[model samples]
Target: MLSYGFWNNKGGTGKTSLCFQSICFYAHQHPEERILVIDVCPQANLSELLLGGLANGGSDRLLARQGAVPRATIGGYFQQRLPSPYQPPAIEPLDYITTPCEYNDEIPENVDLICGDPLLELQANAISTLANNNIPGTDSWIAIIDWIKDLLQPLSGKYDVAFIDCNPSFSIYTQIALSTVDRMVLPVMADDSSRRAIQNAFSLVYGLKLPSDIYATYAFATRLRNANRTLPKVHMIVKNRLTQYMGKASAYAAVLRSIDRDIEKLMDSNPEIFTFEALNDGIVDVRDFQTTGVVAFAKGTPLYSLKTGKRDVMGQRVTVHEDYKANCVEHMNDLVGQL
Candidate 1:
């Protein structure tokens, strides 16, 4: 299966959110393929999203007695608790049927989720210690990959994609997770700290001796701002006049999120990019822009052609403008093609 990890050193960069939407995107586009969602983060946001809360005991309680459940996680595969009678057999969605979740949505039909318990943080370190002490030929990283191969053994030819949601910081656990994956996608915000995170991400990629042609890497720039602001009319006129003499470079801008004190509207309709300013000002069109989430866009055919505006996929009208829809479609198309 093709593995993808949504990662950034910085937190609250929309890593988990992106992963959830991507799964929805693929499931809507290609419904036949099975998918595996592995939550490698101690926060377990991915797991929580997919599996909901734990049963009886909390997820941590279940993790404390990992051996009790043979098909609980990657660790169980190594211990040979999987449903497969033989070693390294293909993975089956039925393996995770015991996991608890309340998603009646159609997107999860082909998905089989492996929930992450809070105890994963401790389990990772314990495995590291054992590997360093008793394992002669293998390191912890290698062991992680071995576990992945076996855990997914039942799904050998069953899935087209595997999405791993990694924690923000690079831990020994992440080192193992990164070394095993074939491709990685970096989600970056258009700010200074995000740039440094990109640099650190490149360092990690460089350290891994992966094949060149296997999977292409790329950066998706989010949350931008226009540069030409707060200038006087005469200064702005002069700036415009000087533009002819200077070549136009790719102007970078960001949608000011509410989290920033400088940004007045975190979820506003204003086009953060400088280029979008002149086309339409004082009005924000949701269809033409790419906001926090785009999958909620309405899906329908032209009937009597009532312009109720953009609606959620359920065919009910919502307030999303036209610009946001266009940008999201274009961006997602490019991403899927690259994949």
Candidate 2:
């Protein structure tokens, strides 16, 4: 399967919301294909958004209280002993998947979720410790870092696309997700903080040491002006949550220009990893659909699915206008098309 990670070291850039929307849009557009989402964030916000009460507590409570049941979570998979690089773990990805039918009988079975666990934070630290102490030639670090990739090997042909949502930190969990993804999507808001976060992300990626031969190939690509090979290429640098008003857009022009200049500088220094053409081709600007976003979150549904009229959300009554919902759907469709 083609895997993509929606992440940024900076939080509150709408990473989870965008990731959720992409998965839902892709699943709806391709009903015949299977789509999977793995929530690696300790907060489990995406899991809670997608699965609702079942993610935090519901059926799991009854199952645990009634009898012994396996902990069906991404973190639970890492609790076992670390395997050698030559040996793959005997774990089934399907066992941990939570289907839509599990949450509600009326929902379709197109998308599945590998729920996240708060305990993953602890597991990440342990893995980091093991990786830090491993000898250079032992290949143990590869196995440790490639744990998620190996875990998903069995499902490579089963799903069309797998989207991973990671925490806004450089923990071992984030590294595992980064190492496994074919494409990386960086969601950045129109602000100064997001710009600094982008710079930090590039520095971290550049510091990572891969195998010598792979590193050599990457170095060689840097010399070739037309080369297009890079590990986990930045598929897009999404300019998210832009204001709808022209005045605000004019005010943000300087910040956007600054970000562009910074990206250009990075490209000049690291052509192999970041290219001018790639940056230009991957940049996308999306507007902030405030009303639609609030309604979607409150109703526990995608923005496109919001209906008109009054509805109860989290014990509060709210009204959704038809024009607003229609506008949100249009923007969402355009966003998905850009992806």
Best by lDDT: 2
* lDDT of prediction 2: 0.69
Candidate 1 lDDT, 182-301, residue by residue in tens: 556556554456555655654444422224423223111100002111210100000000111232342323221211222223113332312223322211211122321432311111
lDDT of 2 by residue, 242-328 (tens): 776746447576777788788777666766663226566767776776766776754347666667788766566778888877866
Candidate 2 — which residues are off by over 4 angstroms? 53-68, 81-87, 104-108, 135-137, 208-230, 246-249, 267-271, 274-280
- Which one wins on TM-score? 2
Q: For each candidate, give its TM-score against the true structure.
A: 0.56, 0.83
After best superposition, candidate 1 residue 18: deviation in angstroms?
Answer: 1.3
